[model samples]
Target: MTCPKPRLQALLSAWNAPQRSNAGFSRVPSTLRKLHGTAKCAEEAIDTSTRRHKVIFSGIQPTGIPHLGNYFGALANWVKLQRNAAPEDELLFSVVGWHALTLPQDPKALQQARMDMMALLLAVGIDPKRSIVFHQDHIQNHTELAWILSCITPTGKLRRMTTWKTRLAVSRNANDESEVDDSLLNTGLFTYPVLQAADILAYKATHVPVGDDQQQHLELTRDIAEGFNRAYKTPSRLFPLPEYMTTPSKRILSLKDPSAKMSKSAVDPNSRIVLTDTPAQIKSKIRGATTDSIQGITYDPVARPGTSNLLSILAACTDDDVLEVAKRYHNRNHGDLKADVTEVVEETFRKPRAEFERLRGETEYLTQIAEEGAAKARSRSDATLREVRHRVGLA
Candidate 1:
C-alpha cells in the first residue's frame, strides 16, 4: 500500500555500500557478477572486493529477545549498509539458529525466538524482495560448508578467539575468558568460529558489516578461506576472501549495569530495553537508567559509562556521531539528557514495533517469506558447494 524506504530499494544493490543508483540486479548466485552501489546479485561468481561484484553476508542468532544492543550492534547497522549499497551488491541476512545452539536453549522458546527475530528483521526494514533473508538451518549448505571448513581451521586459532563466549560481541574484559572456567566451554562454542567462517565462505561474501568485537572472527573467516583455496582450487581459486565492512554504530551498554553490554538474557527487565517495549516502558527504563551523580554531560566512556551509553544511544538514534551529540549536552543535566534520549528511542522504535506486532502472529506469511528466502539462499550457495566438492574430490 505504501512505498518502501528509499534506502530499502537501494541497500540490496551495493556492498560496503557505495552510492545507490536506479538499476538493481536480481538476487545473486554464489558466483555473483560485478556489484557496485546496489543490492543486486548473480551466481557462480567469485567473491572479491576489488571492483568486482560484492556479496555482503551478516548473521543473527535467535537466542532470546532482540534488544538495542543487537539493533545498534548489528541489525540497524545492516539496514544502514543496505541503504547505501551499490545496486550491484548482494545482501544476505541469515537467522543463524545453529549458532544459537552453542548455548543450551529450551526448544519451544528458541523456535518462537527464531520467528520473532525474522519478524523483527522485516519490521526494521529488511525487504525479502531485495535481500536474501533465510534461516541458517533451513538450507543445509551452511553446515555442509562448515564441516568442510572445520577440517582446515586450526584448534589453536579457535582457542585464540576472544569473543568465543558469545559469537556476536564480547561484554566482559576483551582479554579475559578466564572469568569463566575452562570446563564450561563447549565444543560447539570452541568451533563455532569455523561455522561462522563457513557462513561467510558458503556464499563467498566479500564484506561483512560487524562491530569491532567480531573482528577476530572475520580474520579467522579470511584465514579459513585462504586455507580452503590453498587446499582446493577449481581453476585459479574456489573462494575469494571476504572483507569486514565496519558500521558506524557503537556497542550499547546495559541500562542497569553500564559495565556490560545490553543483553536479552539479563534477568532484570529494566536492564535492557527490548525492541518491542512500549513507549511507557521505554520512558521508564530511560528514567531509571544508571547515570552518574556527576554534573553536566560528557562522552568519556571510561569515567562516565552510564552517561556515555545514553549519549551513544541518542547519537545512534539520531544518526549523529557520539562526540558531536555529547557537545549538545555539555551544559545539560542528566534529567534533560535522559528525556531527549527517551524521546528519540521511542521515535526510533515506533513504526518497527507496530510492524513487528502485526507480522509476528502471521504464521503463514512468515513461513512463505522464510521458504522463499531459503530457496534463494540455497540457489546461491549450490554453485559454491559444488565447486568445493569437486575440488575436494568428493563429487
Candidate 2:
C-alpha cells in the first residue's frame, strides 16, 4: 500500500514524539488542518501509523430485518473486509441494542430482533471463528467507557450536530427552527456520539467503516480521543484516533421516492426491499418502481432519479461501475432495465436469504456465537478500560 505524503508523515512523526506532551489545536499539522472535518483526514491519520495493529470496529442497530440498503451499504462491505483483512487483524461487528434504545421499543420484539440480527450476520458469511460478532449490551464496558469520554466531549459540539437536529425537525414536522428545541430530543440521541466514541475507544480500534452520513460522528470520535489524551497527559496516548473506511456500496435510494434513502421507516413497505423478500416480491416491487416517461435509458440522476437508482443497484449487485452498466442499457427501455435489476437482485440474495431462514431456527447456535463473541469482546475492552481508569485517576 502507498504511504502518506512526506509532509504528513513528518507532522505525524512529531505528533507522536515521546518528549512532546502538549496536545492542542494549534499543534495540529497543516496537513490535518487541510483535511479537517472530513473522512480523508482520519484515513490519512491511520496511513501514518507505523504500528501493525489493525483493529476494525463497526455497529448496526437491531431494528428488525435489514433492508436492501443495510445489506449493500454495510453487510456486504463487512464480508469483504473479513475476507481481505490480514491474519493478525481483528474485526468486531456489533448488534447495537443500546443504540436501538434511542427510540421506544417493545421488549419482546427487541429480544427477537437481536437474535434475528445475529443469525442474519452469520448467515451473510461473518464467520464466528474469523470475526467477533456480539450484541453491544452484552459487553458492559461500552457504556462504562462512554461515560468517561463524555466528560471531555464539549456540549457545544454535540449541539452543532446536524443529525439530531434534522431528525428532530422531521419528527416534529417543525416549519421553523424554533419549534425543534432540545426538549423534543432525548439525551440518548444528543449524547449518542460519545457512546459511539467509547465503542471505538474501548477497542482502541484503528479503523472504522461508516456511511458518508456518519462521517461527522467519526470526526467527533477523533476529537474526543484527542481531548482525553490531552487532559490526562499520560506517558503516551492511551487511545489511537480511529480512522474511517468508506463503504464499498453507494447510498441506495428508496424505490418509491428516489430523493430519500432506502429505510425501514418509510411508510410504504414497497419503498425498501428486505433480505427475506422472495423472488416474486422483488420482481413486483421493481415493476412497480417509479420512473420517468423518458424513451431511452441513460444515467442521468437529476433528470431520472428512479431509473438511475435501478441502474445503481444493478451495478452494486454485479460488482461493476455504474457508468459501465449504464452504457449497456443506453438503447433499452425502462421495462428492460427493471427486468434486469429484478433478475440480479434475486440471484444475489438467493443463497443468503435461504441461509438466513435456516439459521433463524437454530436459536442455540446463535446464542452460543453471541456468548462466545461477547466474552472475547469483554476480555479486550476490560483491559483497555482498566488502564484508562487508572490514567484518569478513577481506578
Candidate 3:
C-alpha cells in the first residue's frame, strides 16, 4: 500500500505534479491550455518516469531575525516540505541577499543578518544534507540568469506588477510620509521580480511554496518561463513552469497594530514575537497584545483582528484549525487566551532559539555549509545556464 502523505504534502500535491496535454507534453496549467482549444486535455498532471522528481525552490530575504508572521507564512512550511519530500526530490532554500538589496541596508548589519539567517534556517530543521541551503549571491549564475531574463522582460509588465506598485506606494519620499510615492523607487526593486523568476527557473523548480501575497509573482514567473520557451526553446521545453504550493497557515498579524502585518520595523519591540524571544518576553508580548473588550473570544479576523491573531498563532503552534481553536476559547476571556498563547509560543520557539544560539557561534561550520551549498547550487544550474548561453548565442 502507498504510505500516507505528510500534512504538507496534501497541501501542495494538486498542482505540484505536471499534467500531460493533448499534445502529450507535460506542462504547468497555462492560460492558453486551460482557456483555449484542447479543452479535452487532462485536468490533473501525473508524475511519470519521463518527468524528473520535484525540484522545489523558494527564497527569503536576510533582513533580520524572522518574526511570527515569517515563521507561519513561509519558513515553517519549508521544514515541513523537507520532512515530506521524496528522497530523489530536490529542495533549495536560499538566503536571498540580492533581494534584500532592493531596500537600503547597513553594510555591516546586512553581512551579519545573512549569517544569522543561515543559522536560523538550520535551527528550524532545514537539513543541509537533505535540502540545498545556500546564499543566493554566492552563486553568480542567479544574477547572470536574472540579467538574461531581464533582457526579454517587458517594462509594461513590470510596471503592472502589484508588488512593484505596492513597493512604490510604501517607499517614502525625501520626507517620511508613507504615501503612494515613487521618487525613491529603485531599479533593483522594480526589476526584482525578474530575478525572482530566474531563481525558480535556474532550478527548473516544479513546485514553489508561496504565500497568497506572492501568487502574482509566481504567475509572472510562469509568464516569463513561457516567454523564454517561445523565444529560445527549439525542440523541447527548457524550463518547466513552476506551480505555487501554498501554506495552510493563516497570516499572522501584529500584536500592537492588528491592521498591519507583523513587522521588524515596527517601533514597538513588543509588536512581534521573534524566535529568540525568552519565555518572559513571549508572555509580556502576548499579555500586552491589543484585544477587544468583547464579551467572549472569536476568530472573526476582520472584526476581531487582535483576538484572531492570537488564535491564529495558537492554531499554528498546535497544528489545529483556527476556527476549532477558537471554539475552545469562546467562553474564555482575553486574559485566559493570552496566557495559553504565551505558553504555546514559548514552547514552540524554545528549541529553535536554543539551536540558533548554539549554531550562531559555529562560524566555521556555517561557512563550510554555505560554501558546499553554493557549489551544489552552481552544479545544479550549470546545465541550465549552458543551454541558456547557447540559446542566446553566448556559448
Candidate 4:
C-alpha cells in the first residue's frame, strides 16, 4: 500500500517549521510558518532553511526486533526528522546496546540483536549517509560522559525515576512480588536515566524526538544538564536542554491485551505486529484479535478498548483520523473492519519486510555502516566529553 503522502508532507512541514521558544533558543521565523501552511510551498521552504539548525540526538535500545509500536511511535519519527533536517543539522541515531545490558541478557544474543536492529533502522528509511546511525558502545565517550554526569547526578534523583520502578513492578513474579525490596534492584537499572542524560548531552542535541512515554526521561536529561552547569560555573551552558517532539501517531496497543502498549516482551507473540511478520501472520493475528461484541465500529477507548484498538491501528496505517475512520465504518460490522484493517496492515508491511530481508543478507555492508557511523559519532561526542571532563576538573 502507498503511504499517505499528504499526511507525510504535513508531518514533514511541521517538523521543519521553526519552533517557537521563549527560552533563549533560536526560533522559527514567521515566514517559515506561513510557507509550511501550504503543501505546495513547504518543499521550497525546507530546501531554503534546511541548513540553519544544529544537532539532534535520539537513541533506541536493541532489546528485540522492533514492532509496530516501535515504528509508528519512534523509528518513523526518526525518518521524518532526518528528511526535514538541514544540511548543517547533525542527526545522530544510536542503537544503545549499553542500555540494553541494564537487564539480564545473553551476550551472543544481544550482539545479534544489535546488528538486526541496525539493519531494521536502515530498512525503514533512516539513511546512514544522511543521519549518523551507530552503536552507542562503540563510542567510548558515551561511557566517559555518563561517568562524569553520574558524579553530579544525585542518587536520590535516580531513585525517583519511574521506568525502573515500573519495570520492577512488572517483572515481579506473583510469589516474589511481596518479597521484593529496593535493595534487590540493580545499580545499572537505577542509573539508566543518568546514562540516557549523557547520551543526549554528549551530542549537545538541541532537539530529541521521543514518544509521550519518554517525556519524563527527557526532563531528567534537562535537569542533569542544568545541575552540572550550575555546579561547574561554566562560561556558557554546557548543554542545551532538548525539546520534546512527540510522534504524530497515537500509541499502538496490543492485539491480545488492548489495555497495554504493544511490547516485544509480551507473553503472547501474537500480541504484536513485528516488522518481519509475514503477510499471512499479519492477517492471522488481526483475524484473531480481541474485539468486544459491539455490533458497530466506534472509537471508544474506555468503554470498548478492543474495537478502539482496531480503529487506532487502522487510522495509523491509513493516516486517517481515528474518529473519521470510525464514522466511515459506523454502519459496518466488526468483521468487515477487522478484515479491512488486516489487509491494510499486511500491505503496509509487505515492502518493509522485503527491504529488511535484503538488508539482512548484506551483513558486511551493515557492519561497515555501523562502524563508520560510530567513528563519526565518536569524533563529535569526544569533543563534548573533553569539555565536560575539563569543567569537572578531571583533566
lDDT tens digits, residues 310-353, model 1?
Answer: 99998777666689879978998999889878877876788899
lDDT computed for candidate 2: 0.83
TM-score-better candidate, 1 vs 3: 3
Return the TM-score for each candidate structure. Answer: 0.84, 0.88, 0.87, 0.86
Which portions of model 1 miss their true places by more than 4 Å? 1-49, 165-181
Q: Could you tell me the TM-score of candidate 2?
A: 0.88
Residue pairs clashing, model 3:
18-45, 19-45
Stretches of candidate 4 exceeding 4 Å from the true structure: 1-51, 172-179
Candidate 4 lDDT over 1-395, as tens digits, reads: 54545534432343345542323223334433442365543332222223357678889999888888888888877876787666878899999999998878899999888988889899889999899999998988888888888988888878777777667656552234445577878888889898898899898887777887888788788778768867885676677656566677889999998998898878799999999898788889999998998688889999999899989888777666789879988999888888777766776677778898898889899999999998999899889888887888887
lDDT of each candidate versus the true structure: 0.80, 0.83, 0.82, 0.79
- Quick one: ranking by TM-score, best first? 2, 3, 4, 1
TM-score of 1: 0.84
Better of 1 and 4 by TM-score: 4
Tens digit of per-residue lDDT, candidate 2, span 1-395: 35534533432342234332112212234435544766565454534245675799999999879888889889988887887777988999999999888878899999999999999999899999999999999989999999988888889999877787776565455657667767868999899889988988899988788898898898899888878877886777777777667776668899999998997877789998899999899999999998899888888888899999998898777776688879888998998888778877876787799999999999999999999999999999999999998998889
Clashes of each: 34, 0, 2, 2
- Candidate that scores best on TM-score: 2
RMSD vs true structure, all candidates: 7.7, 10.5, 7.0, 7.8
Backbone clashes counted, model 4: 2
Task: Write candidate 3's Cα lDDT for 208-248 as tens digits.
Answer: 88887888888788778878987986866688767667787
Model 4 per-residue lDDT at 5: 52
**Candidate 3: lDDT of 225?**
83
